[model samples]
Target: MLIDAIRIYCQKNGIQLSTRDKTLAADFFEHPHDYISDDYFNYKLHSFICRSHAELPEIFIVEEKGNDFLVYERIISDFCCLSQHKQQAPQSFIGKKIIILREQPKTLEAEALYATIKKRISGANLFFLPLVAFSLLLPFYSNLFNSRLVYSSSLTSVLYITIFFIFFALLEAFLKTSVYKTVVRATHDNSIKISKLLMYILTITSDDSAPSTTRAIELSSVSYWKAISSLMVDVALLLVFLICIVLLLGEYSIILFLYYLGFAIFCVYARFQSYESSLKSIAINNDRLIDSISLHNNRQQVRFTNFDTLRHAFYVKSLASEKLSHQLDLHNNRWAEILKLNTFISMVLMYIACYLAINTGSLSIATIIAVMIINSRLSAAMIASVNGCYSVKVNLHQIKASLTKLTQHIVLANANQLHLDKIEQLTLENITIEPHGHATLAGYNANFTRGNVVGVVGKVGVGKSTLLRAIIAQAALPHGAIRYNQVNIHNIDALTFQRQIAYYQPALQFFKGTLRFNFNLYGIHDTGRILAIIKYCCPAMTVDINILDDVDADALNFSAGERQKIIISMLLEKQPSLIILDEPTSFMSDDEGLDFLRHLIAQHHDAIFIIASHNADVNRIATTLINISNTGKHKKIFINTPRPTVPITVKPQGGLAE
Candidate 1:
């Protein structure tokens, strides 16, 4: 349990591990963090012992029928040390046993994300609203001119309106540039916010035991872009719509104004109904295909369901969508009937008003013609604006739903400032990881104080990747502690902690962007570093390493090996303190993989590395190798000793490192 680990950690630190400290530990476990100082976690020990893997004693916790239930190195407190996990446990594992010597995690808020979008959209409206007001007033020039053409007065009025339009056009041009920049900036800012949430979600939901599957969290990769893309257009149209309404009432009759409002409402409502049906259709179809696509992307060859089966399933979903569309269309058609009634009422009102004016000799045929033209133009603008507003509202509501779904599962970085500048060491103490309640790895004990290449070797299905994820995240322990420096990782902010650690798994994807974009993610802009990475990854290409103009050559187009190399190169450029690779070089050629590692080891000798691979040759490079067993037991082997080596083939028949 984390309370036990804390007592041990406190014992080593010589801090008074009081009974109140136990209460603090319990509270910290439930909350994960409770605002402790970084210095409180300093794990600098006074004494340590080094021994061969075989010489180390295995400490068993429980036994059944004389079988080992849990086994690891004994807690020789005077010399005990543990590896560090740099972040907090997932939101799902709130009460699980793990060292969480920090403050409680706060809920991620969608309001913060929406506020950024709102600020930008509001700024754009400042420029657009005034232009729309002037455009709406353009049709009311009849009020300025004489009813019958006084030639001089009419010409003057026409010239005055033209100059007014030209003046507003100039203002529009001035604001357009600023508005465009603001929109782009806001979209980019929103992308960063969504990206943060995506990462947080991935961290919590990486394990099967997670409350939900977030591996290919559909929201992370695509939704924000869709939400932000059409926002400005909607805002502009809405401004124009409102301005048109005001102008209608000012230039025409109350009846005409009412007619315009009613027509615009019906038009927007009908369009919104159809738009809603399409949204439902899209959502249904996405649900139908998402699992198959996710499985295919994961590179799993196992056939769960057949192609014809998928086809039939999609057919069923499509039928539902079609039915939904039909229902919406029926409702719209009914509204269309109401619109006909509205048009009849408007026509009758127009005739009465026009008849009264004509009889009073106040309106001429020319003036009536002029009024009709203005009404026609005014209705089009009003309808356009209303439809735009409705579209944006629907999109925003959908996006907010997605955000809410994700925020519930993960705890994001707190508003309170935190930073993990570097990863100096890692410590793990008697940690048992039973993912989905299947005890794949148990009683794993290791002290990696001086960061070095650490490897886990085991047979197929013996939880090598599972253990690696335990250290690298995606899998949280049920008991014990994984601390970095001295602070429980569960107390540290996930994103801040992640900044100091680089994790690469084969299933991860890169963005569809330029070479510079991939490399520039860590805010490192060293030209030499980028050139070195590009030269190693893609030697055959003649493209400029830094400013590769091929923007379209993103993740989809790149080969598997190419994508892997690009990600590795990005990690190398950033030079994080801890580098974790789970089959990272699996896609690369043997020679290519070796060459990349040679460069990596040379540059990043100080960083801690946890590499899990099937290749025996890969494990031979590690300073210490831990052999994982099928019964969730571990055996340590010191490979870097001075002894004559005899090669033996290690197969996947049983859980052994050989």
Candidate 2:
């Protein structure tokens, strides 16, 4: 029983014993049979090690006949002086351990994945309360305030009533827009205010959190289907209400009949307007979902940047104005077909009513015409509204589902950080970074110090940028323990950490603003620091700084080095605790590149510098050099120090010289 307990404890705690870690394993084994190796055990054991050699050790104890034997144990810590990952990769032992591993989907399977997502979201039920309320009320309003052309007061009374209703219509528009805004706010957060509905089409698309083209198309398809269902539900309810109103108001005289018909027509117009407003909300909300995904992923790549692009991609322009128009036109053609059918039925009924009236000597044609008009309007309106409501209902459900999924992802990301915290240095232990099928940084450890220079150098495909990405984002890392001052970064706000550990990659991007605008991206205002870094990185100002205010028609015109300098300068202004420079000097001349590096080291001494490069100059400046290479089943790492050397200059003869 004693041996079994020890073995069980080791397995649960991911304990392992190696030839080198035998003493560490024995220290754990020293505990009595009944001793519990819970959090207390971990704390006690962790406390036993020196601060310099302190590590999170995993010791494994295997059970044999009536005895507990040490299987293996390893004490791992950041290899700041060695390679990218200094931690043991437990995933490598998957076949001998866990039953299954999650496999990444192939790019070819993306379309199928999209379809599955659509089906799931489409199936979820959506609520359309506002549409339901509007549909129900519209019928009653149509009956009570029906429009009538007066034959008594000439055209004067008719004109007066028309103008009065126009005022009423304007009031309705204002009130509805206000109400829609309030609803949008309640459904979303403080970010979207009630006033946003006024220009909902324009403004919402401009939100930084809106989705890009790739995700939007997927979301839009789901939205389109959901809208259809909601529209059907709304139209069905309205049709029943309209039918009830028409039957009740049919007893009124001819003038009243005309008025009711006109009122019903006006109500139809209002329904269209409301549908348009709801569409704007849907567009804005869908984009928000996409933005949330990108933000959570921490992808610098921006997808759909504008509504025009989104609108076109979603087929919104053609669908609403063309496809929908065609559908409506076809419905109208069907209306002609259905109207003929209804008119024939009514004609037969009228003939019977007339015959009966003639025999009783009391009926008139005037009465027959009024009854027919109400009957025709009620039937036509019912069919149109119900069809429209179905479309809206389907879209509403899809939008809700998409948002719900996004919300879940956000919650999970937050939960992962609940136990993580932020500090000066981050250490990874026994980490495996799988960058590709054949390439990975396995069993690697690295330490990043605060306000110090650390350089990462390796051959091609060594997961340099991947390491930086993983540190800034927990979700971004394939697998690792990123510690911020000994606390796992998983417990801290990833966004805040990212901001603190800024990365500058040599990518081309220019904003639609002055040079000052680009520098102020993070809302930074230190102009003095900006100009200084710029001067150091690009002494010549290369592409003419004089055109800083000129509208940049083409960003490609600027040299790659100049673009990198601007980006680095912006990052400098951001003043992150850890700054990652990924091949920043890749495009600069040797003289300019050296100048850039010297400036970075001098100006940002307060920041921990991690540069991924193979430049001899960079290697010489790096406080530590870690090499990453993969062999057979596991990854290998080597740590070395920068050798002291003077500047190596090119001789006229091109012979070896130092």
Candidate 3:
């Protein structure tokens, strides 16, 4: 009957509650991520229309975005409760008062860590300094001179250089590949923070507006210069060792053999050290880059203030980076194709170097053979290095692309957008937030009179908890205005509003702590109110005075429900104006839950109470019974009783009020 009356009132006021509107209303009630995936966000306009009655119209406005619409409902008056609203002509309701609950998305901490690490590593391209330096100087070393190790005659020198270079190239190529795989395995062996990876990737590929990626690349390139410098030290040392051996064995050929062996070992160690150092620098750089990007991200403002527009804006912000990565991949692939030609050129150069040295009379058949082999090895190493460079480029490109999409999808859902305002009071108009998963109250519209008990009963998922979040303005809703006192609460900061109503749900999460620490929160000293709440809420329980001083109070010693009660006691002691107890009985043994409920009711008589449960025992003591259930087609909510109070008999000294 109330819903019908509300519908009639809306119709008389020219309010249009179409099926589209209902679908849209449902969207607001559903989880944001779920709504986005199911395309329910497309119904924002329809949902806005369902909330209008004759009294308030002008306070809310709607705007279009692509195929969807966004509704911005403003609160112009302090009177947001439906019962208190004065009715007028539909047209006169244009700019009436209303309250709005907005949604904000926050960034995850884990993701921030990942992005920081990525930026530290990839932002500069430091890995290349060693490669370029070694490549340019390898030809001057005497290991290639006067020895039959890589060449003999001009033609034989070419063959021998090719053979020796192939072997050296194969060994280095194998070792570099092994090192890369090892690093990848170590860094990602455990739980990886997905958000950080995306952050670093997005910054690298994002447009000019995001310059961190460019900065990161520069830093990365310079850092590798240090690795390259160290490799040069080893190279210079090997040249001296080779020259000494050759001078000593000028008459005996064995000195040449010893020099070649020592040279190979030095080359391997130098490359290994350089590669590892470069990789470490890259990882560190990635972390710093992510941190810088995050700081900048926080400073930027969204153009649209509405939730729908804000969500759309996120997609727009991500587009530039996504496209940039795609273009980079195309460029990298082209480079990969060109490197195939570079490989051949490197091989040709190796042969020429060996032939020239053999003809100079400094290399005999053995020395020429050794020189040719070393030249072939150098050629292969150059090709492998080129391949690794392209590989790094591709990995970076993909990481950025994947990160943009991932951040666009995941971060918006998990970030901390909830405000923490302390609310002194709350008022609900004809406001109805539809039931989603496990909502306690579906359609009932009633005020939580200060210091009164309101009990709610419904089937599972009837929107009981939805009502709580709605009153707090965390979830989306329609069909009513909610106010705190004369102020249309929609205008008030939401975080402050949420802090007013203290809640204890059955699924209340417990962190690692002692019962006393959980209740007191490391607060200095204790209060009488805290002691009183524990006395009333916990049967056969007393506040432990020594718990404050106990060293082992925060260990895992209590039952789940016991911990819940402690949280409840803490909230009750604070004496919030509005209190919500969701399924307080569900978590405990039947008797324990019942005992707790009774105690809560008796103790909190002066606070507005909303008990959400299906237990008949609880409903018997309620002043109001709200039924929330879905009869197949849609959700239906009704107030079963109002202003109900049981009479109690009084004895001479100790008695119940009858």
Q: Per-prediction TM-score, please?
A: 0.55, 0.51, 0.41
Tens digit per residue, CA lDDT, model 2, 1-658: 3344444444444332222223333444443222331111111111121111111123332222454222333322111111123343432222222111111112112233334333432222233333344433433333323433523345787677567656666666666566556544433321121112112222213234423432443445544544444454545554554554344433332333354355446545544444544455555545545645655554443353565564465464335445444544564565457446645654455455445554565544344444344445554555456446545454544444444443233222332243222247767776776655434566678787766677777667767777766766623654557777777665665444535666766664666576656655544334455566567655665544454446652333556777777777766654567777888788887777777887778877777788886576887777776555654254344559786587677789997568
Shift in Å, residue 499, candidate 3: 3.8
Candidates ranked by lDDT: 1, 2, 3
- Selected candidate, larger TM-score, 1 vs 2: 1
Q: How accurate locally is residue 176 in candidate 2, as Cα lDDT from 0 to 100?
A: 54
How large is the C-alpha RMSD of every model relative to the true structure?
18.7, 20.8, 24.2
Error of 1 at 446 (Å): 3.3
1-658, model 3: which lDDT tens digit per residue?
2233333333333333444334433454344233232111111221222222322233332222343222232232222323224432333333433322232323423344334434433212233233333332234233454444334557776667667766666665665456445444433321132223334435323243234443443333333322333333344433443343344324332434443355445434433433433444444444445645664655445343465765565555455445544555565565456545545653454345445544665454444434434444443443344334433443444344433433442322322223323334556666564554322333445565666677777666767777666664455675676665434544554333333566777766644454445554422123454455555545565556554345454353445666677777666655466787877777677767777877777876766787887577787778877676665344455668765387567788896666
Highest lDDT: give the candidate number.
Answer: 1
Ranking by TM-score: 1, 2, 3
For residue 88, give model 1's deviation from the true position in Å. Answer: 41
- Answer with 1 or 3, whichever has the higher lDDT: 1
Stretches off by above 4 angstroms in model 1 are 1-107, 115-120, 123-140, 143-146, 150-276, 285-307, 310-345, 357-389, 406-408, 414-424, 440-444, 451-462, 491-502, 508-579, 583-609, 615-658
